[model samples]
Target chain A: MAKGSLRINEISNAANVLLNVIFILLSFLCIYPILLVIGTSFAEETYLNVVGYKAFPKVISLDAYKYVLSNAKPITNAYIVTIITTLTGTVLSTLMIALYAYAIVQQGFKYRRFFTFFIFFTMLFNGGIVPWYIVCTQVLKIQNTLIALVWPYLINAWYVMVMKTFYNTTVPSAIIEAAKIDGASELKTFFRIVFPIAIPGLATIALFMTLRYWNDWYLPFMLTSDPKLSNIQMYLKRILNNLQELLNSSSAAMQAGSMLAVVPREGARMAICALAVGPIVLAYPFFQRFFVKGLTIGSVKG
Target chain B: MVKTVVKQLKDKAIEIKKKKSFFKDLHDNREYLLMIVPGVLQLILFNYLPLFGLILAFKTVDYSKGFFNMDWNGFKNFEFLFKNPDVFTVLRNTLGYNLIFIVTGAIVPVAVAVGLSLLKNKTGARAYQSFMFLPYFLSWIIVSYLVFGIFDYRLGIFNNIISGVFGREAVNWYQSPRYWPTILVLLHIWKTFGYNSIIYFAAIMGIDSELYEAASIDGAGVWKQVLVITIPSIKPVIVMLAILAVGKILNADFGMFYNVPMGSGALMPVTNVLDTFVYNALKINGDIAMATAAGFFQSVVGFVLVLVTNHIVNRIDSAQALF
Candidate 1:
């Protein structure tokens, strides 16, 4: 019996080793491509001209990054635009969501079911993209403005639902009753007592909001024509759009014109990619818990 | 209740307060009501306002008169979108790619998640997870660059590996439509499966460990336990994800189709999905009305699909159904 158990252990151990090997290979494939992008970005343009692109370069230089950063106007403008919108959007949206969520969770609040359904119903259906565009452009008149980036994602119904659930389950009823006994106003109780404890919840939603605003290129593509008004993602996309034109055009003149257009310079393009991707990766570790928890809670329940 | 309030109250005014009227309750919580106004207003403006604008689908949009003021065309916009020769191709492409995505989406993430769960090495699993999940955070524009690095004709590592090592001819990857369906699917899997796997991983973690321990004592092996205990435990999640995916089958990922192949004209035949089709309608025909009709069509189909699937899921498992 002892010998049989040892044999069983050996076979399982071998299986486990094989599984780990497969996972390692997969992780390497997933990560190596990004490294290739970074490597090519650091490779000198002359070396790029000499050997073309490789996973690892013989000569590494900062010229690609230097060229990308050389014109500070567009890059700086995009950064300022993205940062401002991300901050403003995340803050206002989280507050709006939290307060509304808090209102529904109040025990004596008579309209709880009505308000909950009001938000939850939006999650199931929506007027299509064209109507959304028309509403933003014709009615709101937010097209070609900074507000275009911030407004559409400002109140995701799902985020409000998540906050509502979080508050209902987590916030103790005794604490709110105590606050009321102390003569705390409803808003004062929320701000002083509930909001403080709900920071983790707020932070989780904020991370999602930040990611949404940061990663979005579609809104700017549709709504804005002004380059300065676009976020960094959209700005990079504009450059990419130009590169595609160059690559696809049959005319030699257009192709040559594009090579000089600062967009088709491969090293510079890769550098643009690196710049856009770098900060989010750096922040990923710190917010990893929030993402896992938020996504799990939001989807699994819904 | 009335007798207790009347007899126990120290102040007679407190008796009236304790016996609250509807208006009194409303009046007392007015500030809390005020706090939720912005959220309510936001939903009304962005969401409900768009529902009203869906009438644009029935109109010929005139920039001069704007959306609501445009001339009514009845169903002419839908007729235009559906009547075009390219309509069948675009429809096939959209539904075909979604079908493929649904299958792979169901399988790949669950397999990876299960694989990750089975690993006994904790530190190795964590490290591997970070690497796997990194791509999830990358914007598609950046992903486009990564794809560019792999497949660029002159400078791509793929060409280098093929031509230099194997002496194979370098194929202009973006120019060929035949290769694109495969390439696009692979790209989607790489970019998403890891992130999707996290959901599966969590589901696996939530499975009762005692089930596996019990299986082991019954002479079940590793694969047997996985088959008998693990897969069944996470089946609900897998089903849930698949059903949710079915609801959005009409909507193709715009970025994956548009940005990845670098919008090469040749790949349009393969990559022109519903979302991209709308964008192209704007670009090629400058026909906003037709685009609106297409958007309306996608929305109606998606909504119906969701309701049908939700009904089906509700019948099977009440708890797991998306309400």
Candidate 2:
């Protein structure tokens, strides 16, 4: 019986080893193609065409990077637009959500349920895209403006709900009462006391808001036609789509264009993706514990 | 008469004091209210205000005529959408793809998560989890590029290996509709399984270890313990996720379908869903009203489905209902 048990343990250990190997291989698979693009960008275009994308370059070259960086004006513009929109949108949205959440969670507020339902109902249903597009273009009149980028996604219902739950759970009732007794006005108390305490919750949601803004391509795709107002994702998408068209165009000039495009196509895309995710990844470790805590606190019951 | 006037004045004073107390209550809660104002205003402007634009579905848009001055078309736009053959095809594709996604996509992640959880080493498990999650961070555009690198007829690794080994002809993956459903599903699972597994893994983690200990004490093996304890503990999450997915079964991942196929017309039959179809139609016709009508139709149907699903969930188990 003891020998049989030992055999079973060995089988399990082997299975575990196999699983780990598979997982590690899968991880490499996930990261490989991305690394390929990065590798190909630095390789001579001629070499890449001859050898195909590889683990190591046949001939190392920075010609692509040079070509892409040479026409760096548009790429830099895209970066500026993306950064500004992300920062503005995240801050505005987080502040608004924090306030709305606090108000709805207040027991003394007479309209709390009404306001909560008003926000909650939006999550269940919405008017479709066409009407929304027309409203923004016609009524809001933000078609070509920078505000268009920041405004549409400013108030997220789910975030508000998450924030409200955070407030209801984390903020001690006694602390709030003490603030009230000290004759601290509601706005002052919130900014001074509640805001500090809820930083963990706020930071996680801020990261979410930042990611949403940075990753957003749909709004710019649909709402704005002006190249000047385009975000990085949308701009890159355009460049990519244009490349496909150029590849199919069969013009002599386009053939020349293709060589020039190949470098930027690889480097620019990787650069944009890296830039978009860089801040979030940097901030992630600091907020990792808080994010898990906030998600469980806000979501488990909901 | 003098005595009566004095009593009336006293009553008035008491009423004034109550009003003062009410205002004072508002004053006391001012800080909390201020904290919530920015979030509320942003939502109102961005989310709520755009909802009013739903009215434009009833009108024929003329750029010169302006939004309010546009010709009223009653139900004509919606009629046009329903009348189009493309709408039916799109609706069928959307529902079919999503159903496949929900069923298969749901199962694979749970299985993967359970398998991972069964692994006993702390270091290996954490590393595996992160590995699985890496794909979730990537954009669909990036994912499409990766797919291209693998499946490209000229330079794809698949063709390079197969032709070199077996002397087979290279396949053009994008033009093949027959292969897309499998490809799309596999890709979807690859991209999303890690994220979905996190939820399931979290749920599994929450299960009391004591239950597993008892099962082991009873001489139940690992598989038996997983079957008896782990699966049962995570059943509620699985059910909840299923119901939520059912609510939006009419929608497909537009980015995945549009980008991965890269507008290869040959693959449209299997790949085109409502959103993509509507996008194509809008591109061709520039008919805002028709697009809005279709969108409105989707929203309504989707809303009704969510309500029905939630109602059913409530009936079966009140705790599981989203509301």
Candidate 3:
């Protein structure tokens, strides 16, 4: 029996080693492509043409970065647009969702069921894309503007549902009752007592909204034709679609004649990609925990 | 008789209080009512109003006539949609790809989650998870750049390997339709498996360790333990995910379909799904009626699928049902 057990232990140990190797390879697969992007960004433009994108730079150069920075007007504008939208959109959406969710959860609020059902009904059905597009462009008249990006995504039904779940679990009814008994008004009770306690939940939702706003190209692609209003994602998309456009319009000075011979076409494109995703990639670890927490809680119930 | 009269009077007073409570409740929770006004208005503008706009599907919309007033064209829009042979191809690609995604999406994540659970090195597992989760943060636009870098005919990584290693002519991947289905599914998995795996991993974590210990002591091996205990424990999560996928079977991730292929015209036969189809019809072809009809079709079917899936799940496990 001892010998048989020893054999089994040996087999299990081998299996464990095998599992580790497999997972490490999988992890490498996940991360290697990003490394390729980063590598190609630093690569010399001439070398990039001769040798395709590699896991490391073929010949190290900062020409791409210099080129991108020298013509900083569009990139700067896009960055500003992205930042403004992310901050304002996240704050507004989180507050609106929290208020709406909080109102529905109040025990004494007579229209709680009606209000809850109103949002929940959206989760089951929508009038699809065409009608929604018409509503935005025609009726709301929000096309080709900053408001287009912010307004449409302000109240996702799923986010509201998740916020409702978060509020139900996090903010105990007894605390609200205690605040009410102490003569706190409904808004006061929420702002003073409940809001402090609901910060973690709100933070999770805020992070999600931030990511959504930061990463969205769809709203810009659909709503705006103007280059000035394009966010970072949309800007990157424009570059990806037409590298020749970027090469031709290197700078206003360069646009006077054909100076495409020296343009870092390949390197500049990857550099822009690297720049666009740099913030998210760096800040990922800090926010990833909250995302996991939100996912677990949100999925377990809903 | 006097007692009965008094009781009847008391009941009448209670009835009147109940009747008056609507206004009383309105008066009482007026603060909360004020709180939800902005959200409700936004919801009405964005969500509810669009339902009314589904009328555009049945109408021959004229820009000069305005949105609210249009000629009733009956089934003409839908007829235009169905008459196009391209519609069947798009429909097939949408359903086929989604069905494949549903299967692979369920299996791969669960497998990764289970594999992570089995590892003895907790730190290593966490590192693997973080690395995997990194891709989810990338927008489809950025991912398109990565895909382009890999698939660009002259300078792409794949072309380098193909021509350099095999001594063959470098193929233009952009022009190829046959390779797209595989490319798309793999890309979808690569982008999403990390996030999806985390959900399953959390579910696996929730399972009691004692059950595993008990099975081990019963001389069940790792594989047996997984088959007998771990999978069954997380069955509800697997089922719930599958049902949700089924609910959205008609819908494709529009960004993935649009961006990854880089809008290459040659790849349209394989890459075009319902969302992209509607988009092309509306934007490129300027066929508003046809687009509206397709969008309306998707909405009604998607809504029914949700209801049907929820009903099925409710019958099986009420706790796991989305509703």
Say which candidate scores most in TM-score: 3
DockQ of each: 0.40, 0.32, 0.50
The per-model lDDT (C-alpha) reads: 0.80, 0.72, 0.87
Q: Model 3, stretches more than 4 Å misplaced?
A: A1-11, A250-261, B1-20
Runs of candidate 1 with Cα error greater than 4 angstroms are: A1-11, A243-264, A299-302, B1-29, B63-69
Candidate with the larger TM-score of 1 and 2:
1
lDDT by residue for model 3 over B1-323, one digit each (tens)?
99999999999999999878877888998999998998999999999999998889899978789976789999999999999889999999999999999999999999999888877667888899988888898999998988888899989999999999998899899999999999999999999999999989988888777777777788987788778987998888888788778878889999999999998999999999999999999888999999999999998898899899889889988987877
Off by over 4 Å in 2: A1-11, A244-298, B1-35, B62-74
- Give the C-alpha miss distance for residue A157 in model 2, angstroms: 1.7
Instruction: Tell me how many clashing residue pairs each candidate has.
Output: 0, 11, 0
Question: What is the Å distance of residue B19 in model 1 from its true position?
Answer: 19
Model 2 chain B scores worst on lDDT over the 10 consecutive residues at B28-37
Q: How many angstroms is residue B242 displaced in model 2 relative to the true structure, after the best TM-score fit?
A: 2.2
Spell out the clash pairs found in candidate 1.
none
Report model 1's interface C-alpha RMSD after superposition on the true interface residues: 5.4
- What are the per-residue Cα lDDT tens digits for candidate 1 across A221-241? 889998779789998887787
